[model samples]
Structure formats: C-alpha cells, structure tokens
Target: EIDKKSDIEFTLKVSYLEIYNEEILDLLCPSREKASQINIREDPKEGIKIVGLTEKTVVVALDTVSCLEQGNNCRTVASTAMNS
Candidate 1:
C-alpha cells in the first residue's frame, strides 16, 4: 500500500475549474464572481497552472466528495452548446 511507504508521503488537494466559452471558472471558489479573467500560465517547475485557483485539502474520501458537491451546486448551466 502507498501508506506503507515510509519513504514517501502524500498530500491531496483538489481544484475544480469549468472552461466555458474559453473562460475559466473556479468552481471551488464559487462566490468570487460569475465573470472572471483568470489566466492559465506555464511554469517551468510546476508546468501549466491556473492563476488564483482555489485548492481544497482532502483528508478522507468524503472530503473529496463534499468538495465535488459544493462545486456541483454552483455549476452554471444555461444557453450554451450543452444546454442549447
């Protein structure tokens, strides 16, 4: 098991993003604003990343599911291709 590996430790973090009409939405942080100008940048060390994205630390299985539920509740579904 991975937990049995004393040489390595793991930390789990979750970020939910929605890409609609080429704009990024921070689903984990649903209250900032519906319209945003969030940018994606490439880092040499961390590779590609989304700026100002919210990350939630998950300790248990339910924690990850809770984060999903929070983000799902805030999802925007309207007259887009998926809804049209």
Candidate 2:
C-alpha cells in the first residue's frame, strides 16, 4: 500500500549486483570489460557495508527501469546462453 496523500519523505539508494562464475560483479557500471571485486566490510559505527559498489539514485519507476536496462546491457552473457 502506498500513502499517496503523504509527502515524499525518503530517498532510495539503489545498487545493482550480479553473481556469475562464483564472482560478485557490479552490473551498473559503464564498462563491462572489467569486473571488480566488491569488498564486504564490518564497521563498528555503520555495521556491515558493501564498499566500492556503484549506486544510482532513482525518483521514479521509469528511472529505476532505465537503470536496470543499463545494468542488463552491461551484463556478461555466456556464449552458451547466446547460442541458445
């Protein structure tokens, strides 16, 4: 349920990640040639955090979908999947 009557009070931080061949990769990056490893850190003040992950800000559904499409295009699809 959504409260349409209330004012928008929160900002969402969206991050895209995909795991393939036992490696976690950022899908939202502009370059697909290099997939970097993301660091999982335990901070005393902030608790658990994922460092070096690219995040995008989205205000609407279209923006979210656009971000998803960008990530999907950057995904590394297997040759087998492409052949099929």
Candidate 3:
C-alpha cells in the first residue's frame, strides 16, 4: 500500500510476451487471432522498446497475479500440461 501522505503516486504497468519460433508473441492480447510480431528497437532516450506490445496497469500486487493468470491461459498448448 502507498503512504497516504506521500505526494507522488506510482502506477505500475507490465507487459507479458514470449519468443517462440523466432518470433515475438504477445500473450496478454484478448483476441484469439495470430499473435502480432513485436520489434525490438533501441530508442535515443528510452533505450529498447517492443513495438506493438500490450501493457497492462497493475493496481496492486493481487492485480499483478491476475494479469499473470490471464497471460498464462493465452499460452500455446504443448504436449505437457500441469495442474496444481
């Protein structure tokens, strides 16, 4: 939790993606269509940027977990499946 008296408010944003078959795939996108290919380019000030990536804002720690679960569900199925 943030301090009530703090003057600055922080907002955390995260992006989830995977590199498979020599291509970058965004796992957080809601559409079931083909995963968009992302480009990694170095910017003058920002350094590296992944073009066309979806960034989700996490309000809290619990929200981060929810985003992870959503991205996990979007992962491609493999020969192995684990449930716990």
What is candidate 3's local distance difference test score? 0.80
RMSD of each: 2.6, 4.0, 4.3
What pairs collide in candidate 1? Answer: none
The superposed Cα distance between candidate 1 and the true structure at residue 30, in angstroms, equals: 3.8
At residue 29, candidate 3 shows an lDDT of: 83
lDDT tens digits, residue span 1-84, model 2: 368758658887788888888777888877644447577799999998877888899999999999899889878787786588
lDDT by residue for model 3 (1-84), tens: 457768887779988887766778788888645355467899999998998788899988998999899889887665644532
Kindly report which residue stretches of model 1 are placed more than 4 angstroms away from their true locations once superposed: 33-37, 81-84
List runs of model 2 lying over 4 Å from the truth. Answer: 1-8, 32-37, 42-48, 79-84
Q: Please list all clashing residue pairs in model 2, or write none if there are none.
A: none
Ranking of candidates on TM-score, top first: 1, 3, 2
Tens digit of per-residue lDDT, candidate 1, span 1-84: 877888996899998988866678888885766336467899999999887788899999999999999999877787877567
Candidate 2's TM-score: 0.67
On lDDT, the leading prediction is: 1
